[model samples]
Target chain A: MKKAIQYTTLLFTCAFALGACEKSELVDYNQPDMIYVFKDFDSDVKDSASYSFAIKDESLQYDTVFVPVRIMGTAKDFDREVKWAPVDSLTTAVAGTDYEILPAKVPAGAFSANIPVKVLRNTAMKTNEVRLMVEIRQSKDFAPGISDANGSSWYMPGASRRYLVKINDFLTKPNNWDSFLKFFFDTFSQVKYAFIIKVTGRSEFPSGSTGLPYAQFVYYETVCRNALAEYEAANGPLIDEFGNRVTF
Target chain B: MFTSIKYLCGITLAIAMAGCYKDEGNYDYNEINKIAITSDSTDVVVSQQDTLRINVNLSQTMPDASGLTYQWVLYPTGTAQTRRTLSETKNLSAFITEAPGSYVLDYFVTDKKTGVSFQKRFWINVVSAFGEGWMVLEEVNGATDIGLVTKGNKIYRNIYSATNKGAKLPAGANMIQIINYRSDQEIYIFSPNDMIQVNYIDFLKIKRFDEFFFTAPEPKPQGHYLLGGADKILYNNGQVFPVSLMTPPPFFYGLPLIGENPYYMEPYPIYSVLKGKFFYDRISQRFYRAGPYDIELSSCPAYNPALDAFDMNNIGKKMLYAEHNVTDQHIALFKNNNHDSLFIYVLDAGIDNAAIGKYDVTKVPGLLGADHYMMSKTLTYLYYSNGNKVYKLDILAQTSTLLYTFPAGAQVADMKLYLNYDDFEDPDNYRVMGIATNEGDQGKLYYFHIAGTGNFTGNTYREVFSGFGKLSSILFKSRS
Candidate 1:
């Protein structure tokens, strides 16, 4: 009986020791640092964006486009360089003539940085659009993350490795002309648009939910009407490129 | 068996350890001071610029009212809620200067010892001192001013100048329009070269012509009208500018309504929520319609000659006056280019076959020479004034009756029927007529109460107010 009691006491001691043992330190998974191009939450484009200089001022010699790059892993305390290059086969714009890719770097303690690309306005862009395809390359600090494969786990496919930009300077009909702007501007013509730009000194007339106030549109209409009348009075009837009499 | 015994022993040891521990901290409890605030009146009505007083009684459990701090707050109950601190005393004796509307008043009593606050809410109705009256637009000494004739037959002359620091309106001010939306009451004074909007409560200047637009158009206001109770439309330089008052102020006019072609629209607009807005395009000599959401004017569908009374697209006459009568039917008066032929067209406010009837009223006495016209809202009669004689014409019976005549050398300046669309249940609405006449620099305003049969109640004017000026228009100001 004495021996049995001693064994029970020993068993209770062992149970108490086992119950007190637990993990007190956190585990580190040590995920590798990765980087990618940041995508706008509101935009549907995965890896591409289109730009036009048609609405820009004629005197604007050069414009810069900033592409945001994000780090998929933890941010660093020191600044890191981001390696990028243009795909040769898919690129139609010459590096030195049509555009210049500026040096890209992620700032210290930042999750994202914008890569600025300086685009030059050339006479050729008025007749034909040029394309520049940029892709992320592996660097000392980061590896190209989020692939363009079909079954990637990333929410946005092809959003990390590649980004394409289409640039042009040719004039085209505004997307909101028929739905909204027609009430103020009766018809759309290249010559009429140019005249409007000259009179209002503004090329961008946005419409839809995020457009300017209706009062601004009315002011523009009145100004354009008066300008057109004065133009016709000074010089005979203003005509469009299509040989049609331009009227507001 | 030994394994089960070992587990039981371990559990017993854990329970014994927990049961042996005891709390060593000391705690004490005491009751907090309770406060009670009471007021006799929870709903009060007062006029604008009048003093509002409220008495309150407060009691606390621990001490008397000496250790209590009080605060009174007032705020408008409209969509644009603004809070104002009225007083920091126990009793409120505040002079209300807020616009005429509904407001909420809150009284708070805080106990200094316990830091507890007790509150009570009260409802207040603020009516304007210049409420529910006729605003007479008159030209005094070649400059525009306004007078008010209250429902009690009291005349307040030059009220605009009195409230606006003696500043007279523009010289050519010809119209007065009152717009009430949500909790806003605005008075617009329009002139040929300028326009001004004033506050309904004090007649203080709110916005001038240049302030009404992003890029101000020419100051040539033909007329101003309301569309569907929420949108205000202004006509200037043969263009229509509409602004929805539901938007926050300072309100700016939207894009003008321009169709596929250039056209000029008459200032008078026939509007109803169901029918949207209709306008007479003088350039085309036709009628146009625009839906509530439409931003441009659209041509009315072609009328069938056999089934329709008249073609909306082919009305080849100049519009003189157009208005909607009591039954919501539209009546328009027009004349040919020669002015020898006069016509009256009746149309439904909103229907497929809009034309109701068309009649030649060229032979109707006093109509061709009339300078001011008013349509009766309760009957099928048209009242017009020429020289000093007022005449009423019955369209269905094709008869004319002389209503009244002013003194010799008196000329009718303006005429209007008392109609308040917002308050249809008011006793004085749609039951009276106001006429203004000028005689050698003296303007006289007369109010006639109409009977059910479209005749004067006593066969004479109920009230007459005379002063110095040349009255041009009279519009009723409502208290909402």
Candidate 2:
């Protein structure tokens, strides 16, 4: 029993010594070298700056469209700088000719900033399509985030680091035109024109002569469209005072 | 002597050595002694789908970061504290699921090296999305629709139509009441010709209640409660045919309904079991006490011996407007007698002339009995309407004071107070009321807040919404 006791005590002493040595030699590594930017873009709705829409010639006055930018893991004390520029060869919309680009920088401790771009109007580009694509470049203060598509975060990052800007006079076709919007738009147009012609007794609608505001466009495209649909469903398809059926 | 001492010391040292093992070297004696859960509130009330953030403040911890295990266990509150792991992080939050009612969240931590553990429990109340709000019943073009107004002033219309298999609530529902019974919430919808009950938790499933629950049959009952109906009284001990008042005391569940043409004016008041389980039966211009006699003391006021019976002939035959609070055992009202008389009947007073008084509402002269009215949740005030004018009546003082009078032609259709009794984190502040009224051709809800006194005058209100139908009855569902 004495021999066994001595052996156990000796083993315990050696184990304790080894544990103390191991803990004393532990090292510290708690620094992060990179940060991330998160975006929450739900494919279901293009309501915000999801894709691209235009100010068009119908808007007599110039308008500015603001794009949102966000970054994660921002330092509390120092401000971070990010560089953005339009790819010259691929860009069709001129800077001073079409739209003006505003200052873009993220303040200290904030995860979000807005990039404002001024869009101009020209009657000649009413029917033709034009786009301005801006690409993001990394800087010393920040980089493209480690997690590009963060499902957990609010803002979803688009493919690569690209933003598309457009300016046009006519209604920019919605993305889901073929699947859902086509039928509603067609029906709404027919009823709308008929109602307009009957009310004003004119060949062309006055609002159409200029252009519809983006907000008015959405309202007429959805809310008013549904209301008119309900009316037509209760009654039959709309026709003019002279017994002429209306079509877009 | 030296030899004997040497042998004893050797045996002692060997025993001590034998007690120590290699396991002691691997185990860390240091561990967390105490732990506390800190948040905006310990007893928290959250709406469905809301996020709850919890931060754990630890008194001590193991030296190695990887040598500890954290767990957040959630379960319903009670003896059956079945464990459900919500998370394993040190300090973070969890998005509340759609489950409603009281819950217990326990933060458990175990030291991997020492096998020592610490745990603490947090009480979290998850209420339905319909928390702290008034459920308005609107009569649109003769059809019944229900609206919800939250304490935050958010309003929803025709919730019954939207929630229930697209089927509308009982059309032209005259009254809406939320009753708490047997560990569940039942919302009763009353129409003049029909009646139905639905579960407030689901807001979709209609309960197949006992046929007797339908108080308003073809003839219309003068009084209703858990035990009595149109002209009958039932016993709590058994489900048998009811008897008359002339029968034995045990059989007399309620007073007999009389009068050739009695109109059951008071809507059935939803109450907790501790308060007035019995209801008031008004027949032949007389009020009779009806319901179970047994109730807890804290809920009921000290019984006043003078309130056995009272003659309400001066007030009127039908109720112009009436609301009863079971917890306080009082029914505040505007008598259908149409004499501008407002009265408060304290059930504690058990005598023939037990009415507190007959107060005149002359201060608000032009006001009518009521177009739509409601009793404040505290049972302290009775809000009634004349046409466009609304007045607040102090039950104790028996005085009616003018609170608001809408535009000359605009008529107030309905009124309700939003009360939050289930929330423990927030102090009781009954500052908001929803009003449905018509100004011209349009009917809409002009929900407003009574800031300083909640007296209706100079209170801020927004014409927040308009609707397709006329407003009928608005009720704030209480979470008991």
Candidate 3:
């Protein structure tokens, strides 16, 4: 009888210990399924968030940069996967050789994620000034906040997911790309380490691989159209270099 | 008995060796009837510029067919089916065209009732158009005539009248084309209802057509006769005929090109500007190109975002006139069907956002485009008219300068570029501009020169003539 009373007291103490341990249960943050990322989601699709980086760090090695991705909605119950991939189909970049992208996912229960993309800031990149453009796409688990940001994406406004990045240390750039990034778009974008599997059948910008020529071609088309529209209203329609009416 | 058998065998052998035959009962004789074809000339030689006609006489038995059909098939020498059926009729007359080779003009008659047919072929040799000069077509007094223009500006006008032994030239000649076929040059005159083939050298009428095709056709055999007509593409296995009568006619191929609109004239108007051939339906706004196989066709409106397409409704036929600049590779000048808008075509290089590969000339330093524009042979400068003033524009520089100022109230009727080619083979040649002014009572041709490096800088014109009637078109006949 004495042993049974002592065992009952011990069981009560164990139950109280278990009840005290149950206070830290998993919390449901009720976060939205659609969380946006990227920095400049508000500009036109052709207008991408641009960034530039010197090929070398202070130690004279290749430079590593991180692209910031922020969550748009509330936090989640469990760790959520934010899928990310390089818009590599249009890129001539190689994952290991030219650049790198690591940890293409948002960690569970994290409010923000940083995509580390590093490039071979070598002499070739500085000389060619080759540009790489990428956009963050929505996956099955997560949807974008804004639609048509960076052309047909659901990234939220001001979350410019399309990054037009380059590795250059030029003292004077022809198309003023550095100024354009600083003034027109954001300047804090990293290289997208997507790879180019195909060497042909791509809609290359009119400028080929040159940094500013493609931009200039697009700008010329737009400005010329605006100028021509007025000419047609007063004189008739504008004629092309071929002497035919422009349909635009 | 052995001796008698031997003798009988010997006799049988002898008879077999002598080709002996025996009659079973009575022999019968059958008479097979046949038809004959006769013509005045069986063997003839016609130049590529000459038309061949033969009046054939059919035997009495040949007319016994229920619906006796006739096919004048033109077959080339050395084994070929008929390239085209020049004329099909039951009448005695047969029309044939020769395309640079020895050909067999097959006169075929078939009886639809009995399915019996007869063929009488005549030999015809066609000379090629090598070493031929230009054949200029002139429209005077609202009548059309052909003029033979040899080297050194030697011109013989009214060759159509001369070819017809002094008959007046046709009244409704729309266009003239000197076609290079059979290695020879032949001239074709297009009218509202006829296509007259005239000898390029002799200026003699070769053949006349009552039913010729205009636009993309269901395929007919024209041999090389339709070289500049519509698409200039024939649907054949590339052979001249004895038209295996089993096949269909050759047809018009190729979709309309940039700046080619079908000029709805009864007879199709096809004009050659250098190596380029243009077929336009003036009323329908359908344009066709004779050259450049890569020209976008098939799926048409020929989507061109570079060109400023005329608004057919608001412009209302004001923006459809098209002019070709031989020096410009892929450009065509289009004035609004009749409106004041001027559009340019970069041929197949269609622009983005524009409908048919064209663009409106922007507001430049001076006038850039007009209802009437002329391009230099160098492909650099363009002359456009705004009212009575003609402005010269440097295409590369995108600047316009006044080139010529006509007399007040005198509308510039026509502008032509005359290239004094040092060598006929070279595409680039030094050229001058000829402007025709219509001052109500009379028309005058003025010659001028503009000096610039690939541009016309000054406009100093000399009056060439004042006696001509309303001058319609000007063509420089170069060597073929």
Q: Which candidate number would show the highest TM-score if scored against the true structure?
A: 1
C-alpha RMSD of each candidate structure in angstroms: 6.5, 25.7, 30.9
Each model's fnat? 0.15, 0.00, 0.00
Please provide TM-scores, in order, for all candidate models, with all chains considered together. 0.74, 0.45, 0.34
- RMSD of candidate 2 to the truth, in angstroms, is 25.7
Docking class of 1: acceptable
RMSD of model 3 against the true structure? 30.9
iRMS (Å) per candidate: 6.0, 27.4, 46.6
Model 1 DockQ reads 0.24
Assess each model's interface with DockQ, reporting 2 decimals per model: 0.24, 0.00, 0.00
Q: Write the per-residue lDDT of candidate 1 for residues A1-248, one digit (tens) a residue.
A: 77579767776676676577566788888866777777654333345655668888779878987777778888899998888888999999888878898878898999988878888889899988899998888888888877553324346433467788777787656656766677878888988988899999888777543566665676677678878878988998989888999987
Off by over 4 Å in 3: A1-248, B1-142, B147-155, B209-297, B300-329, B332-342, B349-358, B362-371, B385-389, B395-399, B406-413, B418-422, B425-430, B434-458, B461-466
Clashes of each: 0, 18, 89
The stretch of ten residues in a row with the least summed lDDT in candidate 3 chain B is: B238-247
Tens digits of per-residue lDDT, candidate 2, B452-471, equal 55475355464466653666
User: On residues A84-187, what C-alpha lDDT tens digit does candidate 3 reach at each position?
Assistant: 55676666665665576654556777777765566655556555565555556676656655434443444533455555555554322222334332221212
What value does the TM-score of chain B take for model 2? 0.61
